[model samples]
Target: MIVIINYGSGNLKSIKNGFTKIGEETVISQDIREMEKADALVLPGVGAFGTAMEHLESYKDIIHEHINNGKPFLGVCLGLQVLFTKSQENKGVKGLDIFKGEVMKIPEEGLKIPHMGWNNLKIVNECSILDGIENDYMYFVHSYYAKPDDEDIIAATTNYGIDLTAAVCRDNVFATQFHPEKSGEVGLNILKNFVKSIPSK
Candidate 1:
């Protein structure tokens, strides 16, 4: 079973519907026991970084355990931000630190604050979640983006004034700054790839 972590800060239904559209079923739950038994874990959110992390406090340890055990994990939007060390979005509030990095606001040098709309991806490195998906447009909606301490983990990028981190992957962990669920066929393909990454049980 796939579990989409519901910490009171995400488009849970849209994510679940996306999975369902691809002939996969998902459960949206915050119950530790439910998450513990999931084949794959998905963290999808659209909200303030600090607030999301606070609500996710209970699942921190379990999330770490899931990732450390080599289980497939996917994070989207604010979900992706929380995987980092910290963020300028909410100073002093530490992130999950799954990937050593900091989130910063999109530079406001005659550019838009929140980069919303469609943008194509520049595949930086091969990541399972991006299988059969390259240079395809994906939907984005955010003002903050992650800057990993190690560039090696960057999987894809999209330019919006400055080259922004579009997606990241490290071992069993994967995340996207954009919303795959809202990216049409390209998004569904991404989710399908994620489903394929799950181990057979």
Candidate 2:
């Protein structure tokens, strides 16, 4: 089983459906006990950063424990942002600190606030989740992006106004700033790679 963490912020059904389309069983829930039985974990969210983190706080221990135990973990959108140290989305909002960085609003000088629609990725490093996805268009809907203290964790990037971190990974943790569920074939392939990468039970 693959557990999708539901903290009242993610696009739950879409994500679950995406996995099911690829023939992966996923349960959307907040039950830490259920999460522990999974071969992999996925955190997908769309909402205010502060509020999302508040909901996720109670489950952090199980989340961390699951990942520390070497289960594959993937986070999407707000899920990706919340893994950082902090965010400007809601002033003084602290993140899970799983990665060193802060989220910031996309520079608003020239481009649209929420960079909506298709964009191509610039692969930063080789990652199994991104296999065969280099230069392919992926859907994006966001206003803020994460700024990692160490650039080495960046797995891929997309150019909006500037080069934005599209995806990141370190050890068992992998995350994307875009919604693969909404991103079509390329996105599904990304998820496919993720599902395939999950350590065998």
Best by lDDT: 1
Candidate 1 weakest ten by summed lDDT: 192-201
Worst 10 residues of 2 by lDDT: 192-201
Give lDDT tens digits, candidate 2, residues 43-100.
Answer: 9988899999889988888888887898899999998999999999987877988999
Report, for every candidate in turn, its global Cα lDDT versus the true structure.
0.94, 0.90
lDDT of 1 by residue, 129-166 (tens): 99998899999999999999999899999999999999
Q: RMSD of each candidate?
A: 0.8, 1.1
User: In model 2, how large is the Cα lDDT of residue 134?
Assistant: 70
Cα lDDT of model 1 overall? 0.94
